[model samples]
Structure formats: structure tokens, C-alpha cells
Target: MVLQILFIAIALAGVALFSYNLKKVIRNIRIGKAANRTDQPQKRMMTMVKVALGQTKMFFRPIPAFLHLIVYAGFVIINIEVLEIMIDGIFGTHRVFGGMGALYNFLIASFEILALGVWLGCAIFLIRRNIIKLKRFSGVEMKGWPKSDANYILITEILLMTAFLVMNAADAKLQAMGAAHYTTVGSFPVSQFLMNLLPNTEGALIAIERGCWWFHIVGIFGFLNYLPYSKHFHIMFAFPNTYFSNLEPKGEFSNMQSVTNEVKAMLDPSFTPPEAEAGKFGAKDVNDLTWVNLMNAYTCTECGRCTSVCPANITGKLLSPRKIMMDTRDRLEEVGKNIDKTGNGFDDGKSLIDSYISREEIWACTSCNACTQACPINIDPLAIITELRRYAVMEESQAPASINAMLGNIENNGAPWKYSPADRLNWAKES
Candidate 1:
């Protein structure tokens, strides 16, 4: 009973910390400009189910996909056992759910298999990131904390699974000896192999079991706290992010309402344009982008899949869609932190355009949408790129001479060519 009470206190404290961090994250996300994603509820919900839950986009690379699926399944499914652990901890009970007989055995067996799968998946991911040294894993953006973050998750997951297996192994050994309170409860087909390494004594087995139990649960709580500081927060944010993803056609761009209104009045000579509020053109800073854009920032897995498929990156251009997303998130976080520190209303002088993302990098994009398609979580870095381009062209009129010429031609000749519409047929002859 004393141990049970102590466990409850620690668990509640962990829960409190997690909730506080989660609230701060939500506050940061809300700092972004408003965007309405409330339409098409059924469609959005279906997308969340299929894309986030089903992981439909992950299968684009079969090997990583399969391995990721195993880890994802283990992470999700093993939490069911955590619920039982919580029950046992609170009630001072041993094998509380063991009363279910065959069902309990099946559950235990399945958990053992999943725990094994989790370890296997983590091992391979570690090898790929460190040993084989996959190119995507080693880039300018993945230096320092990013690389360490990946390694930390992989190592911690492996250790947690090992702890679980060790506990099961000791428990199985205890059961074999008919030890009191240890109970012949769990079926440990996988951990049974570890039995020979463990002592047959009752006291030693109990100590082993308790130590592993404490480590596993405490580690889980620590991981929960670690997530808000890491890209691994996507494990929780992906669902809502996918649900709120922009459903516009991939090829379509969202024209600003201000631009649309101006064009309408220009087309109709006598039409009266509404009194506009004089909004700033395009995305000069994090505040200029929509809340969904900010949500995309939070949802980024930093997986480098977007960068891997980028034609610009492949062709040796300065642009990397993955980097674009990271920079946006980083800048947004900086702005948010500034706001928190100064207790002011969004007065950060550093904009995302020149401070974080460069003009050359934004302009290098072909707008191919490959990055958007390749993203497993539906992150559209292309959208952020386009908005930044809009800022350069409209807000600052900073487009290149060649682009300026094209824009002038369109305004004057209704096409990219310098010639008038009447001379359009002369192109073939001139060539």
C-alpha cells in the first residue's frame, strides 16, 4: 500500500508536467494568424484516420515503412499494458488482469511479441542513422540536437523494451518456483530465453522485477516530457494536423483576397471595391502565415523524406523543402519565445525571409509539389515557399530583372512575350 501511494504521487506529477508543456505548445501555435479549416468535417476526419492513423503515405519507401509500422504499432499497442500497470500500482495488486485466464495469457504473449518488434525496429533505425550513415540523416539541419534527438529516442526505446523483457523474464522464473505474490500470471515466450541468465532465488527475482518495473514506467513519463522539446511531438500532433490540412487542389494556389478584389475592380471599370484594411502582402514573418502553417511546423517529423524527393536539392540547388519547414518552425518558436519574454505583442524585428530563409533558397523552388506529396504527415513546405515568394514580389517588389521583365510583359502584352497580342503568330517565323 505504501509503494502504491508513492507510485500514484509520481504518476500524477508526471501527468501534471506533461499537461503544462502541452498547454504551452498550444499557446505558441495560437500565436500564428487565424485560418479557417472547419469545413468538410467528414472528409477531414477521414484524412486523419487514413493518413495519420493508417500511415498511408509512409509506404512510399517500403523498407522504412515496414520498420516504422512495427515501431508505431508497438508504441501504440504497448500502452494498453501500461493501463494495467497503472491499475496494479494503484490497488497494490499483482497480475490484476490475470483473472481473465486465457485472455490474459494471449495479451501477455502479444505484448511480448510487440516488445520484441519494437526493439528490432529501434535497432535497425539506429544502424541506419549512425552506422550506415544515411545521407538524409546527416545534413546541415540535422546537426547537434537533431541527430542527438534521433539517437536519444532510439536508445531510450531499446532500453525501455529491454527493461520490460527483463521484468517478464524474472517474473516467469519466479512463477516456475511457485513464489508467493509473484503469481504464475504472464506468458513470456520471448523473454523465456533470458531465464537461464537470471537466478532461481525468490528475493533476487522480486528485486529484479521491481527495479525493471520502476525503470520502465519512469522512462515512459520522462519520454512524455521530452517530446515537446523534440520533433517526436509529431506522434501526438499528427492526428489534429492531418485533420486540419489544407484540402485545396495540390496545383492550386490561394490568392490573397486583397489581390482578388483589386483584380476584380480593375477588370470592371465602374465597379466599387470595398474599403480594405490595408493588410501586409504575403508572409514576411511567422505571423503572416496561417495557423495551419504553424501547425505544419509543429507536426514536422524532421524525417527528411521531403528533402530526399526534392528535385531542387537533387539538381544541386540551394533549396531544401525539409530545411524550409525547419526554419519556419524555428523562427516561429523564436518569435513565440520573444513574445513570452518581453510580454509584448509580436514585435520581433527578425522576419523569416532574410533572417532564417534566404531569397535564393525560396526562388530556387520549381513549385513541383513533390515535397508536399513525399511528406508522410502531409506537410506542405511548398505553401510556405510560395508565400515567401509572394512577400518578395508584392511587398518589396524585389523580384529579379528576368522575373520583372516577365511580370511587365504579362501586364502590358497579356503574355510572357514582349510582342503585342496581334504579333503572337510571328513567334514561329521569328524563331
Candidate 2:
């Protein structure tokens, strides 16, 4: 009865989670729209697949990357055991892989070792985030965030994974003590050692074994249900986000509608045209943003690599690349929910430059492309900043005086520095 109940519970939970994730996938696809790309479709797909499955981005930090590689590899390989357990729950039989007992034992030992490595990695990450207190790790000026939420999610994942390992060890010990000696004696040395310490009574061993199994199963299910609402949501979001990353000419900017055509009729001969409504110039809400930009927000892992590389953040500028992504995501979720409830979308009249992000924060960016180059998931922060700049200067006429002066000089003298046009040939002369 206990086994039967466990089977039913696992099946129901798995179905529910699969259904929920499917709906989210469909919704994101509909929202993503159609993007024109300059890169060959096949090349872009290959790059995305390599990065997503290969853990390419985590390698920015070698120690963390190595540890994560072990854990990731183990997670992928050890899922066979999970499938076997699910099968056993459905059928009365326990072991599903009858032919490869030796291989199964070897895999179990490998996963156990990897689980230990993962624990160490989690410890290092926790220490870095909490004790080291590096500026880059802070992400942004926003006080509560990533520091708190990120820590919570990381700790929970570590705990859950640790529980899985403990439960396995206990189950192995129980099996070795019982009359059913299914496993090869020499292959499972750790279980053999553990069996020496445990009681021989069937009822007592069975109770303990059942308790551990329940913990393992419940831990997995709880982790799944909590995922979407937690910082760890990125685990699920990252896959699809990577799959749909922008695959275009990195040097080129997205084209905007011709401003002349849209506003020519609105112009009055006697009066200057009032600034076009705000949301028209830059993204003020989720719907206003390109689908790729939205996916960038979802994909960010808050790993602080971008924040570490950001020149502005390095120089004590208020910008944190990670925070920029987080803030955009937060604002999008907030505005999306409001729009959903009220059926009234963005304010539509306010420029993103003046309302959403400050001019100082925007202009402080040096276009060094460090953030873009550093992002693990191919998020192009520099591109977004440049697009916003284009809107501000060309559409809104809200650029700083220095920028206007530079433009004027370029127009009058054919150079931004007001150098003589004749001097252009001087560089070619021997100097």
C-alpha cells in the first residue's frame, strides 16, 4: 500500500509539473513573436545548444565551473536511477535495469562522489556571497535583492541535493542488511560498511527505509513547485531563454519605424511639436520591449560576472549589469500583472529615458561591451543601451548638450572634434 501510494503521488506530481511547464513554454513562445536574424539559423541553433548543454558560461569562474560540471554531469547521468525508481513505483518489481548491475553500481558510486563535490561547491558559493561580500556580488544598489533571495534559493537547492544523497546512502545500507542481497557485494563497499552499523530487524529497517524514501520524493516535488516563484526559477527559464536568444549581427542595431512618416502629419507650422508620448521612445513596460530583451531578463543567472566586468560599476557608477537585468525583469512582471488585471497597458505617454531609467545611468555606459562579452547566456546589454540612446537622440531630442555639440561639429566640420576636413588626408602622410 505504501509503494502504491508513492507511485500515485509521483505520477500525479510529475504530470502536474509537466503540464504547468508546458503552459509557460507556450505562453513565452506566443509572446516572443517573430524576430528577423542576420546570422545563419543553423549556426545560431548550434551555438545556443552548445552553450546551454555545455555549461560554457559558468567557466568564467574556473573553480565554480569545475564544481558545477561535476554536479551537472552527475545530475544528468543519475536521472536513470530516478526513472528506475518511478518505474518500480508503478510496477511491483524494484530494479528496472536488470542487465547492467555492475554499470549501475559504478554510476551510483560516481554520483555519490559528485554529490560530495557539489556540497563543497555550494559551501564556496555561500561563503563568497555572504562572507567575502565582494562589491560585484552585490549586483545592484537595490538593497534586498539577490543577496537575500539568491542565497535562499542556493541554500535550498543544496539542502535538497544533500538529502538525495543521504537518502540513497541509507537505502543502500538497508538493502545490504536485508535477506534480498540484490547488489554485488564488492561493488557497493560503502553500503557494506554502513550495513555493519544498522539493526538487523526487518520491521525497524523497513520503517527507516520508507521514511528516507519519502523525504527524497517529497524534497524533489517541493523543489519543483517552489521553482517558478524563487530565484532558482532561472533553472527552468534558462533552457528556453537560451534556445530563443537573439541571433543577429552583433554590430548592427534594430531598425526603428521612420519618425518622419509617423510625425509629419502631427507637425504644426506655427509651433514646435510636443515630445511624442514617452513609452514610444523606449521600453517602459514588458510589452514595449523586444521579445529577445524580455528573454534576456529571464535568462540572467545573477552570477555577478556582468557586474564585475561593467566599467561603470567598477568606477563607482550606480549601474550594475546584473541589477539592470533584475530590475527590468521586476518591472516587467509588475507592469504585466497590472495590465492583466486592469486591462489598461502602459502609460504610453512617458519616455523610458525620463521615467524608467535615469539619464546619468544611461550615459555613464561607455559602450565598452564588457557586459555583452561577459554574459553567459549571450545577453547583449550594450545593444539595449545603444538602442535606448538612439531613441533618446533621434526620436525625443532629449540628448545631453555635449552630444548635441558633438553632432553639430560633425555636421559643420565633417569631424566630431571640429578638425579641418583637409586634415583628413594628413594622417596618410608620413608622420
Candidate 3:
């Protein structure tokens, strides 16, 4: 009774810690300027179901896709077993659903199969990242912490799954011996082999079972806490990110509303443009960006798929869409920490444009939607890149000489070339 009470207290404390961190993330996201994404509710629901839940975008690359599916499905579906673990932990019971005989056996068998899949999938991913040397997995962006993080997640998952299997094996052995607290609950089709590796001593067997059980649950709590600080936060945020994806055509770029409103008043005589909103011409920092852009930052997987397909990156230009996302996330984290420390507003004076993402990288973009399409989580790194460019051009008038010449031509002659509009008919006659 005392042990169960202590376990329940630990479980509640773990949950509390997770909730507090999650709220911090939510608060950080809300720091961005508001834009309404509340439109198209039904379509949003279907999109979340199709893209995030189904992981349809991942299937574009077959081998990695299938392997990812194994680990992802295992992580999600096998977690149903966690419910039983929780109930048993809290109530001092052993496999509370054990009474549902055949169904329970089938569920356990399925979990074991998926656990095996997760183990295999992690192993292959480790090989692809470390040994086989996938090009996308290395590079400046993935050099130190990013590379280590991927390996850490994969290895931790392997160990967690192993602990689960070991726990089941030891439990099954105890059941065969008609032990007291370790009930005859689960089917160990995969774990039965592990039983032979365990000791013949009953006390030693009990220790192994308890050790594995406690480790599995404790590891899960640790992983849960780690998500807020890791790219793995996407495991929770991916659904909402996909659901709120830009519903417009991918080729379209979102205009800066402040600039657009200015142009609207100039063109439409009857248009009563609302009083000019006060903000930077475009995003100079993370807070200047829309909440959606910030959300994209938080959700980035750092998978480098955006960089892999980038025309600018391929052609040796400075732009890397993956780096843009990382920069945004890094800047956001910096700002978040600053806020926490100083309790002051985001007036640290350091901006993402100059400090983190350089003008060369932002200007190198062809504005191609390749990066947008390549991101599995629907992250729009190109949008952030464009935002920075917009800030440079509109606020600082720092457009290149060639672009300035084109703009001058447009202003004088209503065309890209420096010819009067009245002379436009001369071209047809000459032709």
C-alpha cells in the first residue's frame, strides 16, 4: 500500500512538471503578434488527421519513411500499455486489464511486435545517421548538438523498449512460478526467449522485474520532460502545426499587411484603410513575426530536408532554409531566456536579421517553394526568410542596385524597362 501510494505521488509530480513546461511553451508561442488562423475549421480538422496523424508527407522518401513509420507507430500505439501501467501503479494492482483474456493477450502481443519494430527502426536510423553517413544528417547545422540529439533520442528509445521487454520477460517467469505480486497477466511471445536469460533465483527475478518496470516508467517521464527542450516537441506540436498550415496556394507569398495597406490606400480612392498599425515593416525579430511563424520555429525537426532540396543551397548560395528555421528557433529561445531573466520586454536590441541570419542568406533565396514543400511538418522556413528580406527592403531600403533599378523603372514607366507607357504601342509596331 505504501509503495503504491509513493508511486502514485511520483506519477502526479511527473505530470505536474510536464504541465508546467508545456505552459511555458504555450506562453512563448503567444508572444508573437496575433493573426487569425481560425478560418476553415472542417478543412483544418481533415488536414490534421491526414497530414499529421497519417504522416502522409513522410512517405515521399520510401526507406526512411517506412522506418520512421515503425518507430512513430510504435511510440504512439504501444503507449496504450502505459495506461495499464499507470492503473497498476496507482491502485496496487497487477495488470488491471488482465481479466480481458484473449483481447489482452492480443494487445500484449501487438505491443511486443511494435516494440521490436521500434528497436529495429532506431538501429537502422542510427546506422543511417552515424555509420552509413547520410549527407543530409551532417553539415554545419547538424554538426554538434543536432547530431548528438538525434542519436540520443534513437538510443534512448532502444533502451526504453528493451527495458519494457525485459520487464515483461521477468514478469512472465514470475507468473510461471506462481509468484505473489507479479501476476500472470501478459502474453510474452517475444519476451519468452528473454525468460531463459533471467536467473533461476526467485528473489533475483523479482528484482529484475521491478527494476525494469521502474526504469521504463521513469525513463518515460524523463523523455516527457526532455521534449520541451528538444526537437521532439514536434511529437506534440506537429498535429496543430499541420492543422493550421497556410491554406492558400504554396506559390503565394503572404504580403506584409502594413505595406499592403499603404498600397491599398494609394490605389483605391474609396478604400478607407484602417489607421496604420504600429509595428516594424516586417519581422526583425521573432516577436515581430506572426504566431504561426513562431509556431513553425518551435515545431522544426531540424531534419535538414528543407536544406536538401533548396536550389540556393544546391547552387552554393548562402541560403539554407533549414538554417533559417534553426535561427528563428534559436532567437526565440534567446529571447525567451532573456524575458525570464530580466522580466523586461523583448528589447534586447539584437535582431535575427543581422545577428543570426545574414542578409546574404536571406537575399540568396529564389523564393521557390521547395523548402516549404520539403518540410515534413509543414514548417515554412521560406516564409521567415522572406519576412527578413521584407524588413530589409521596406524598412531599411537595402535592396540590391539591380532590384532598385527595376523598382525605379516600374515607378516611372509602369514596367520593368525604362520606357514610357504611351510608347508601349511602339513595340508592337516595331515587331
Candidate 4:
């Protein structure tokens, strides 16, 4: 009874703490302006199914994708055993599902196999990131905590899997010794080989089994809480983010509604423009961006796929799409913290522009959508970049000399060149 009470308390506390943190994340996401992603609900559902559930885009790189698929499958399948653990924990029963007989055996055996796959997959990933030092894993944005976070996650998985296997091995040994409360259940194809290493004494076996049981559950709880602060939070946010993906043509830029309204008012004598919204041109901070844009920032996995395929980054420019997402998330978190410290109206005098992201980085993008195409989860860093550029041009009236000259030509000549429409054909007029 005491053990069951302790287990229940720990589980409840872990869940409560996680809920509080997640509420803060949702509130932060809601700080941004509204967007119309509810249109085409069927298409959005299918998008989530294809990308987040099917993981079709991960196959662009076969090796890592296969490894990731193994880990993903393993993590999901093995967690089914956690259900049994919870039931047993709550009732102080030993292997409550063991009464299912052959079915239980099959489930346990399959879990062991998958646990092994997760173990090996995580090991290889760690080697690739640390020993091999893959180019995608090394960058200005990946330096401090991002690099360490990946390593920590892999190491933690390996430890959890080890604990799980060791616990099974100890339990099997205890059952063979006819120990009290040690039921003869489960077929351990993988942990069976590990039995010889354990002791013959029943007390020692029980201690080992129970210790590992506690460790595995506690580690899972810790990992659950750690996810929100880590890049791995994509495991949860990826579905909604992919569902709300922009389904428009990649090359098409969304015209600012404010600008369109102003233009219409100028052209028509009696046209009444709608009242300005937030009275801001483009996004100067997180509050100015759409909610989906903010969600995209939070969903970024920092896998560097977007940055790796980015033309600007490839051509030695400072515009890393991964960095742009990271900057937005970091700045948004900063704003959230400021609001928590002071009231809702608090301002730290910092904005997303100039403070986190630079004008040069924003201007370096070719708007080719290569980054968006390469992302496995469809995170659109290009959207954030475009907003930053818009704020610079319309609000600050600040742009590079070349861009200013181009805008001048567009306004006067109706094109992005010095020549007029009449002279557009002069070059091809056999001159």
C-alpha cells in the first residue's frame, strides 16, 4: 500500500508540473495575432497524416531516416508496456496483464525487440553527431545548448532501455527461483541472454528488479518534463504545425492586406478602408506575427535540414533558416518571460528585428523556398524572414541601397528596372 501510494503521488506530481509548463507554452503561442488556417480542413488533416504521421519527407536522406524510423517505432511500441506498469503500480499487482497468457507473451517479446532497436539506433545517432560530427549538426546556432541537448537525449534513451532490459532479466531470474510474488510470465527473447549475469539469490534478484523498475518509470517522467525545453518537443507539436501548413504555391508571396486596402482607397473615391489592426506594418515582434507563425517557431526540431538545403547558407551567407527559427523561439520566450515578470503590458524594449535577427541575414534570402521544401515537418522559416523584411521596409523605412533603387523603378516605371515599359522591347528590337 505504501509503495502504491508513493508511485501514485510521483506520477500525479509529474503530470501536474508538465501541465503547468504546457499551459505556459500555449499561452505564449496565443500571444501572436490570428491566422485563417481553418480553411480546407480535409486537406489539413491529410497533410498531417502524410507528413507528421507517415514521415514521408524523412526519406530524402535514406540512412538517417531508416534509423530514425526504427527509433520512432521503438519508442512508440515500447511505451505500451508503460500501461501495464501503471496498472501494476496503482494496484500493487505483479504483471496485471500477465493473465492474457500468449497475447501478453507476444507483446513483451515485441517490446524487447523494439527496445533493442531503439538502443542501437540511438547509439549510432550519438556517434554520428559527436564522433563523426555531421555538418548539419555543427553551426553557429547549434553551438551551446542545442548540441548538448541532442547528446543528452540520446544518452538518456540508452540508459532507459538498459534499465528496462535489466529489470526484465532480473524478473525472469526471480521467477525461475520460485520467488514469492514473482509470476512466471513474459517471454524475454532479448533479455533471456542477460539472465546468466544475475545472481541466484531471490532477495538480490528482487532488489535489482524493483530498483530498475523505479529507475525506468522515474526516468520516463523526467524525460516527459524535459521535452518542452528541448528541441525534441517536435514529437508533440509536429502534428499541428504540419496540419496548419501553408498550402499555397511556394513562389507566391502573400500581399499585405493593409497595403492592399490603402491602395484600394487611393484608387476609388468612396472606398472605405477597414480600421488598421494593431496599427503595425508587418511583424516587429512576436505579437505582430500570426499564431501559426509562432507555432512554427516552437515546432522547429533544429534538425538543420532546412539550413542544409538553404541556398543562402550554401553560398556562404549568414542566413541559416534553422537560425531564423531558433531566434524567433528564443525571442518569443524572452517576451513571455518579461510578461510573466511584469504585467501583460510590459516591454523590455527589445524586438525580434535587430535584437535577434539581422537585416543582412533577412536580405540574403533568395526566396526560393528551398528551406521549406527540405524541412521534414514543413516548418516555414521563409514566412518569418519575409515578415522581418516587410517591417524593415514599411515601418522602419530601412532597406539596402539596391533594394531602394529597385523599389523606385517599380513605383515610377511599373517594373524592377530603370527602363520604362515602352523601352522594355527596345533591347529585343534588333538593336
Q: What residue pairs are clashing in model 4?
A: none
TM-score of each prediction: 0.96, 0.81, 0.96, 0.98
Better of 2 and 3 by lDDT: 3
| Predicted candidate 3 versus true structure: per-residue lDDT over 215-318, tens digit per residue | 99888988998888888788998999998888889988876677777788889988888888778877788888888998998898888888999998988887
**Each prediction's whole-model lDDT (CA):** 0.89, 0.64, 0.87, 0.91
RMSD per candidate (Å) reads: 1.8, 5.2, 1.6, 1.2
lDDT of 4 by residue, 1-431 (tens): 99999999999999998999899889999998888889999999999999998999999999999999999988888889999898989999999999999999999999999999999999999999999999999889999899999999999999999999999999999888888898899999999999999888888888999999999998998999998788889989999999999988888888888898999999996999989765688888888888998999899989999999998899899999999999989988888888788865237778888888999999999999999999999999999899988889998989999999999999999999888788778778764
CA error at residue 279 for candidate 3, angstroms? 0.8
TM-score of 3: 0.96
Q: Which stretches of candidate 2 lie over 4 Å from their true place?
A: 1-11, 14-18, 21-34, 141-145, 179-204, 237-240, 246-249, 257-281, 345-356, 411-413, 418-431
Candidate 2 accuracy as TM-score: 0.81
lDDT per residue for candidate 1 within 1-431, as digits (tens), equals: 78998999989999999999788778878877778899999999999999999999999899999999999999999998898888888888887999998989998999999999999999999999999999988677899888999999999999999999999999999888998887788799899999999988789999999999989988999999998888898999899999998788999998688887888899998878899766688899888888888889888979999888889888888888988888988887787678679976367668899999999999899899999999888899998998999999998999988999999999998999788899878868885
Candidate 4 residues lying further than 4 Å off, grouped into runs, are none
lDDT of model 3 at position 402: 89
lDDT of 1: 0.89
* Higher-scoring candidate on TM-score, 1 or 4: 4
Least well predicted 10-residue stretch by lDDT in candidate 1: 339-348
Better of 3 and 4 by TM-score: 4
Worst 10 residues of 2 by lDDT: 181-190
